[model samples]
Target: MAAATAETPTDRMPILAAVCLAAVVLPLGFAGGAVATPAIGADLGGSPTAMGWITNAFMLTFGSSLMAAGALADQFGRKRLFMTGIAAFAALSLALSLAPTILVVDILRAGQGFAAAAALAGGTSALAQEFEGYARTRAFSLLGATFGVGLAFGPLLAGFLIASLGWRAIFLSGTIIGAIALLLAGKRMRESRDPHAVGLDWPGALAFTAMLTLFTYGVIEAPEVGWSHPIVAASLLGAAATLAVFIAVETRSARPMLDLTLFRYPLFIGVQVLPVATCYCYVVLLVLLPLRFIGVGGLSEIDAGLLLVALSAPMLVVPLIASQLVRWFSAGALSGAGLLLAAVGLFWLAHVDPAASGMAVILPMLLIGAGTGVPWGLMDGLSISVVPKERAGMATGIFSTTRVAGEGVALAIVNAILASLAEARLSTFVPQGGAEIRAAAQRLAMGDVHGAAAILPALPAAEIHNSYAVAFQHLSIVLVGITVVSALIVFALLRGDRASSPRAKSPDDTGFDSIKTGSAMS
Candidate 1:
């Protein structure tokens, strides 16, 4: 068995570096969308709704391609697929920078998402192929840390680039990073391939993609078009039908894109669910925080961005302490506790009125940040630990797809809730006979604060300000309820026992040895 052979320090160096680079670049592509929203909207002459399609386009493609890309990684060589993905992503970024219209930019963004999915799926699978047992666990932790680093820094980088050179420069910077990483990867990385990998599951891929596309599109548009609209209703119904077909196909296929049998492992299933719920809660908070600080609190854009530094500070601090916590507590306990803390933090945030200072909100943000960090690190490690090495690519893909789906749902739900609340609230204020107030409230609800000043003629300044403050407070309560529900779901899925540790087997254990031998043979 390959497990019996000792790995020299040099043998691990190249793949480790490849993993690090892949981790940083892939997430940067996704995170860049969040900060570039305002600039993109302004330059492209699109409203907030159109700008949202920027993310929706990328996320839909990215999430949908995961399983297919993972299968490709297993069939072809990981290094080859990864380099191809990086090159494609870099080219797309360059194209996006040069795009003359919003539609072109969005198309490029979708292409970039496809490239990113390939890179992430291939590169992370390569990491699993190169390491095992405690080494694999540590490698996954470092991968999580790298992802956190990207999440923490991507916005700050985007903000700086936008401030200095405009939004075009942001895509240019991504192109440069992707080019550099591609060059480094080509120079140092070795190939990893499985001979036994079955032919491409085209029907499975198409069915799954159709299902995800319909579902994400329905969720994304439901807030604006109303759930009962023909398009929304069709999308929702199509998604259900497509998903059912996908499951039936997978069950019958000789080589399924997703081996549904994996779900039979309760521990593995529980571990995967942790990230889904955590990601949903985390994205919801991230989306809402900027609005709270800048839109309602009346801070400058720069100040609001700076305030986020408090929320991100823990990403740096928490990784150093995470391994220690894992040693002392089970992943389930740690994850559940983290979700609980985040819920509490969200509840605390709900009580924050417009008058609250940055200091008052900073603590809760920090707590939520720290709490979320634990599960973020544990999730990938736990999911992969229980799966066979040959299935690592598929497992990681599934876990990632689930996490992104959770994010999409979170964004959709929050947007729906906020839109509903804002409309309901606006109706009450509109009846009070202030046209200016009604328009300003409508703009705020639609996430169009830049156009807000144009609509503030029918009311005094004080009342307009008060209306926004009240709306944000109501939105915070919705976020609080979301976190609480998220916590409950996580707790229910996670088993309480420490004995369920995914990485419990030692390097010499048969379970570990078998996977390594099977992977090498394949």
Candidate 2:
């Protein structure tokens, strides 16, 4: 409290700027790395599997290390971890830009993920420390908006850089941003740590990271090798066992980093579900729709990027608007209504032809982005609101882990579903129950029409595209159903109720109780 009170608005501005800069770099890596992958493969000459790792390596490590980073921030120091992370991120980005081989790129990408986790977990927690009450809400809202800016422009920027400056420019860009954030935070941000924090929860940390790694690996591999494949089966089983071990360790630990009891609070549970719901309703489409437009619809990369802009554009303003709307509406009602609107957009997107004029898709994309933006803006602030401020690092960590890990899982599941559905549709057209059709379907589902053609030289490209289109339509319907169900559940869980528990801490320093649906956010 002394640290917070000591900082005037002028002092806090640099802290906010630093965290926002770090936030922007993260999504840039996410979206930009995906865009740069093809170019990296072309220049470095790697197998499809190795090429996939360029992105997968970053995601797996980033998602797995978040919880550990969060706990460490609380124990060690948020400002200390934040500065270290940004410095490491800058160093790694420089190394990635100079990487001579695809293997080097993959390894560096993994390192980048670890750095990202530290920067995000520490930076966000530091933000919670610097700003309180309504100001905290506004700061987090700006953070969300900054993330949207990265996601919204990542593709277009990456595409331009790849075409004009080479793929290395993408990593170089990250380096520049990271260096700036590092300098700003190093000079101004004050260090803070939980006085009650104990020694690291080593067993729980190991188990949780292992669980995420195994599950993500299994999901990524499942689409390529059949689910029945021994490797995929082993990985998934191992993940489940590790998860059980993690739960046991946390429940028994004297100072568990995760605090599993938080799950007992309905408000806490509701806050967590928001990200997973958005992953399915909005995040997956960021990957899938581009594949549909370029591979199945025969659009150029430029055209595909434009459509993606349409899809993500609403994120720019919609989230800020949703923040203001909290003044009059229950966040629960707003969140539920937003998801329903996104579901409607998904339904419309399902029926629209991917190759059709851009206008046909623009309206639906806007609807989906605008709808999903509401929860995105609120979820960050709500994450801390439900817990004591001293535990802000842990709360931010849990929310972020759920968001990033949930995205990886969701993308893997949807990709698997699309591949399976395509396989079924391809069988009807090819009339052969063989490995060739299965292989071709997997490629088609991933938006690699040329690759599918290579495998099935006899099959017509039109038939392949047609099969993929039908599969995508089916997948969209499935997403629609899930979003609707998630909306109802979220509304029910979040509708104007305070979390109650004998062990729960008293109201935070701001004296605000758990955020309710219809109350002022402060």
Candidate 3:
């Protein structure tokens, strides 16, 4: 039977490689899934709501279960969960390729999200167990870089696959990566669990999952049914009530899955802001732009992928630059400044014509990427730094949960807002038609040109495109305001924050130390 294995210097690299490979699957699935959306929709011919769930289902499950997965990793065994997760992830990817209907694909994508949570939570926890002090910092630093690699290249690779093979090739690619990671880690990694861990926080877990589900469902359905629809209103209200319950459960639990006390620290609040800020400033664009470029703008999958490369490539180098810049500037200052720069990019992007050459928008994409990279570089280290050494796992779990849950929530909100705005614009364009025009507007917002055209046979394609462009520009301006506000809040919360020298030793020699960030990713 597999048991805890003694680690020497030789064992560390293989373990790191294994987990890093596992890390790549998350962003690759995320960015690649978005990039592949148009192809998937074109082939399957699903409604706008169904196609939206193609990405939403995955993110929703992945985000909601993360803290529970982390708790399970500590209660069971990290290696056991890691292997189970990776093996299932690969199998699901293969299944996805064979899925016959969009509904089946959406169901399988939900499974993929759950598997991703297990693999990431287990593998990351295992990594923390395997390394010490500076070595641990370096290992995580490299892991963050691996995520960047996946984000930077996932769209391009997915585009190539969809163009050369089919949309199914995207899932095939995931299977291959999962298989390799499984083989590498199966024999080398050690089993680990927290001896002090108690029973799983079932109430807290249930409450949290319900809250996210309700909130995401409300947001996704709002644009379709109208925000005031009874179903949407009920879902949003339920989410808020569930959230209150979750907080209460966590606060009272003997051993909560999410430790509520962490919020007492201003630095912790500041760290959480970084991810939410980027979620708006950067991550949401990964989905929206691909839809705009491929679906609305009529660019081929391959060309859209190339455009995404420009948006993501700066992540590769700007993070390293941010890491070094932190030597002179506080992380708070750098992060706030970065968000401000991203705001500038968003403002610039709002004015660019969709029909213009790709070169016209490349600079703004680069600026947004480069700006967000600063906080992305420092975020991992700061996540654990705010807590004591023994709580490292908890800190990591909270940070990751915040980052991913924020992504799912933010994506839902932005998508709803964009669709609503498009509907409003389309109303002015086609003043006479009512329900038909509204339906077409929703489809157009999602880049479903054929569907929109079918819904409103008389509408001009140029008008559909123009409506989406104006809505997108309005959304960008809203995002700019949100980002600028978040920057000021982050700056204030982290006013006195500073990173220790990379060589600085902790009391236990196992605490987090300063580190440089590397490449940017999705």
Candidate 4:
């Protein structure tokens, strides 16, 4: 790793703003794309299979590549890497806006996601290094709040912009904001790196990436192509083999990219996998709800965006609230409670027909939003808080990877579930169409009603609508089941664990050691 170097005086304001903006943009990229999916897909003539890829490809590459990028930030310099990531993210996003076809956009989105990994890893490391004591906790809370705001506001803003300016405007907006963040971050943040860092583990990185990619691909394609398809079987089998190799390599490596030893800590294991439950529900809904609103309710884009506030607004407010509540309740309490609330929301939502009124969607979303707010903020803070300052890079790596991977997998699983159900219900409606009706069901799951209808002349609109309504409830029940079971599991594992407990504090707390009294942070 490079030695720390002298730099210009650090300005916390600009650094904070830049990191917040970067975090905001990351989710904005996802949610905005979700808001704009129909327009983008329609223009690109994208099939349902390809439509999912527009978002999934980015998430797959981003989630898998994060650890490698985080390690590189530790080896090189975080301040520099952070700025470079911002710049690359801007360029790639701009390239995405100009892409003529959906395929090109998907390919570039993955590249942008890869670049975003650096921003995420570097930004969190910089924060942990610069802030300390109670102040560091405050910073983490604010950081989480800003992240929620970005996610919450994404649909609202993207809705307006896409309505007036078109879908490409969303990426163009990212390009502009990223440029501004690049300059601010470059001028304000100080340089730092891990002094004990060794060479990169290229083999481990490849194995890790391949494992996640193949597994995600298999799950996403299963409903469309069938689980027994040779390609799907190969992908899942390959993922398993690669996972074993990754674990073996990490256990043996002197300087592993991902320290599997961290799993020994039960709390770490619980907190790390928390995303699998929360995001598995949250992100899939983020995709499906918009589709339901626009496709079934026939709401305008702006109306749909406004409706989403019921979900994301509570998420935005909860972190700031959680930061203060830690004085009364433990992070684990808030997290577990949040999951239970989410389960309740899911159960409520499961009963709502797809053709239900807007209020039907809004009420459960508020409950889910409030529940979501509690955990994400604390879970994120704990991820870094649990580890020593030196291992912040690794912590963020695993943390970000888990969250994004869960999101991608959840989206895929939901898509598969809905598609499978759609096909089953639709088969009765279009019995004569055979395989054509089956393919149409996949399109239905991807939120492509027109595309699905275009494939079969006899595809009854009533049948299509009923199929989706049923599919949504089935997926919601699946989510409810998972969230409740997960909440119970976490309660069992993390019960009595308190954030205020000294046990929760890292023995190698960087807040006391990493930051010096005043001047600048280098």
Winner by lDDT: 3
Tell me how candidate 1 scores on lDDT: 0.69
Give each prediction's root-mean-square deviation over alpha carbons: 4.6, 2.2, 3.7, 4.1
Ranking by lDDT: 3, 2, 4, 1
In model 1, how large is the Cα lDDT of residue 25? Answer: 66
How accurate locally, in lDDT, is each candidate? 0.69, 0.81, 0.82, 0.78
Better candidate number, 3 or 4, judged by lDDT: 3
Steric clash count of candidate 1? 0
lDDT of 3 by residue, 443-485 (tens): 8768776677887667787787788789889999999999999
Clashing pairs in 1: none
Sort the predicted structures by TM-score, highest score first.
2, 3, 4, 1
The 10 consecutive residues of candidate 3 with the worst lDDT sum are 513-522
Cα distance off (Å), candidate 4, residue 400: 0.8
Off by over 4 Å in 4: 1-10, 430-433, 496-522
TM-score of every model versus the real structure: 0.88, 0.94, 0.93, 0.93
| Model 1 ranges off by over 4 Å | 1-7, 291-301, 354-357, 431-446, 450-475, 485-489, 496-507, 510-522
For candidate 2, write residues 27-66 as lDDT tens digits: 8888777767656766998755576677778877887788
Model 3 steric clash pairs:
315-519, 315-520, 316-519, 316-520
Query: Candidate 2: where are CA atoms >4 Å away?
Result: 45-48, 431-433, 499-522
